[model samples]
Target: MPRFTSRPLAAAVLAGILTPAIIAPHAAAVDYGMDPDVVQNPADTPNRPETSGSGPSMLTQGSSDGTVTEGLINDYRPQTVNPMFPEGRDHLPTADIDMDPEVLARLAEYAKVDGDRIRQINAYSPSMGRTIPLVWIVPQDLSEPRPIVYALGGGDGGQGRDNWITRSDMVDFYSEKNIHVILPMLGAYSYYSDWLEENPDQGGKQMWETFLTHELPGPLEAELGADGTRSLIGMSMSGTTALLYATHQPGFYDSVASLSGCGDTNSWLGRRGVASTIYNGNGTPEMMWGAPNSDYSRYQDAVINAGRLAEQPNLYVYAASGLPGDLDFLGPNAPADDGAWDDRRGPGFYIEAASNLCAHRLKQATDARGIDTVYYDFATTGTHSWDAWNNALREFWPIQARGFGIDGGSVTPGLDGEEAPWVGSSDSSRYTDLFGPSSEIYGGSTAPALSSRLDDPSLSSQSSVPDGSSDSSGSSGSSGSSD
Candidate 1:
């Protein structure tokens, strides 16, 4: 037999040269052990969480004022908002998306969704100047509109091969939950930022920040039955993206989270990660954010924006210690000389180590500002893998749920172990007072009406008129609108 027969055999099988009868015997002999039912669901694993530390799961740090919590958490035992469902009712996936038929007609489908759980929809992004793929975990059973939780993928924007869906069980996990989970396969290595110029390697103009915050939401929300509230959760590469997006567009996301991501893009390690992630994908930092140490660079750093994040009411930040955990494939059972450890596991350890530092820095920055909305965790043992990320998600859904305007989805510790009581829509974080009516931004389902700050006794009497002066509050506030 030739040295490599797998490819030829696979090709022959696809070409119909090898019928089922010819392949069945060989296939049956091979115990790939990949049955979805038998194989452990990443969403369901790490169940035996035995943290010896007595500290809170929510990263709490001492501040001049008092205690401070770190990024994303689930403290919901807040007994107010109506639950989206009964304790046990599971909502079936349904939708009334009103995307433009012509535009929808233009986008080509990359791959069909799986398990009747996820729906793959394509859209032409005006910002990217190309079609984009969106995996929408539509809310289970629609009545009143629900919030949208944008779960972004990690790694260089992924070419349909590497992503949350492909590498993790989070898709099925979120699908079963109530909130709408929209994962846009975007900005592979650009940090999901608006690039000054396009990198030919990146294909074209990468106006992701604008695309997500301004362009996509306008039309996408218009067609959907979404509540005005939206949240973002991202891992690794996009983790920083989520932080910056929520930071820059304050009052846009009800809650935001970053898992195993660096917050200080201006820091030496943070910049190194950014440069490597971008360049590895055949991109350059100049095209993405301009020259190093530029004002624009500082503006992009989440640490520098901590004060802005401080204003955010709900946030979650998490990173593992980088030591191998139960889910790491190259753990104790794998041979040391296999080269897999050096290639993957080794890099994972250091990557997570770097992330741990970033997470601490973010906590420090937010803490210094007296932020109290974070639910953070710095795992004692975990790798830069989905097992850990899923753990974070299971734990953080409460924050997301709180912001979504409802409650009930969260992982609770039990005598046996930890389990997700519910994962779908009872979604929302505590609604922060956002400016402007959502209608002006999302032509789709409108979010809650904006609360006028002018109503507050704190404001001094001023002309609600546009005095050709630099002050914008007077003019915009009077219109029941905002910038």
Candidate 2:
């Protein structure tokens, strides 16, 4: 056998392929720009507009103050108030679909030790041509279909699965109640919307709204033992997504809950914060909904669409101040040490404060529209961490169970659960004013009469987008309504 030398073989192959004549610069160059057809025009691309620079800078225009001005608040007053959910509309998905087998195989890798009861599956989306990872938890005794709870994660992205299992007792709670909990791992910094443009770094078309609302439900109901009835609960970033989804698709969810959620995205500070978040997450605001002042941004805003949220049968919104509460120091969920507390305090403080401001803004919009379907909880002492969210989840379970039309009495540990050790004590007194009779923090008592145009049966099943509309580049006559 002949002895083979690796270096000499590689050198011979490279030397043969890469000659000096080929590598040398050519004196003559061809100008492809001269041929119009040779170079594809950037403007001709679908839904993509090529601009000179990165459109606009949100940093210069963003507000540092957490609160919106009185003028800005007044600007949102509606010229014509419309009913959110018209009667006789088909709220459920009409199509029958199945998950791709290859996608299912990929999702099976996320399964934990208890693979049968708890398995992570990738839900396929035809619109996006990709699969999103989702952790599914079902009770072993599944003789019949169970009501579904769609739990969305916050800014940290898809951590809701881990959080629901470890940071909170939701697994035990849902297991005992025989409920189906779906936790979607939507990746970090995804605001859970259909992005205006594809993210180059993330490398996928994020059609989250279409996936959740139109695609996932049909398969879930047929194969995953899920009933038609559903509820939505989200924290932080997803809190806003949950609110938008419930409002955008009327009658889809029986109840909706937001924990430490930012609800106002149209305000100067709100828009700024959203822009900043997108930028930090390796994305651009232009890719999300166009410029800060574009119609896409306005339509997606929860505060701008408060009238839609008011139509839901039940709504729960909760937020907290950055201040350390009694539970922060004393509960089983409390920080392990001072260093842990300190580590969480900085971001937690700002996020909680911002969420409080957003909650107030959302309340203002709902109250102005005479929408009264919200249960508000503005804790006086807490942060944006999981501890506050876990507490809110425990407290909101009764309301969630009621929305599912099931007897809430069967929920584990009752209201006396160890998750909330300070439920009835003075330690919880700080949030009393929010739920009191004279609470100005909630919405109005009466709903306004619906306009004829809004009550038209023909328009009930119509899509959220208006007729004769185009993309979000402001080229169309009018920006269509978001569904």
Error of 2 at 425 (Å): 21
Best by lDDT: 2
Candidate 1 per-residue lDDT over residues 365-411, each given as its tens digit: 44333454555555666666655666677667766777777774542
Candidate 2 stretches greater than 4 Å from native: 1-113, 159-162, 337-339, 409-483
* Candidate that scores best on TM-score: 2
Report the C-alpha lDDT of model 2 over 1-483, residue by residue, as the tens digit: 100010000000000000000000111222212122342211122333222211123333322223322222213322112122223224533323323222232223222314567664445556666545566777656898889988876554532222555556677788788888877654445577878788654436876777787778777677777777898988777787776776677578888888767756655555556654554345655677665435565566676566676577657777665666766666555667666676346555666666765665565445444455566565768766666676777667766877888876533232223233323211211322211210111121111112333334542211222222111100000000000
Cα lDDT of candidate 2 equals 0.51
| Worst ten in a row by lDDT for model 1 | 10-19
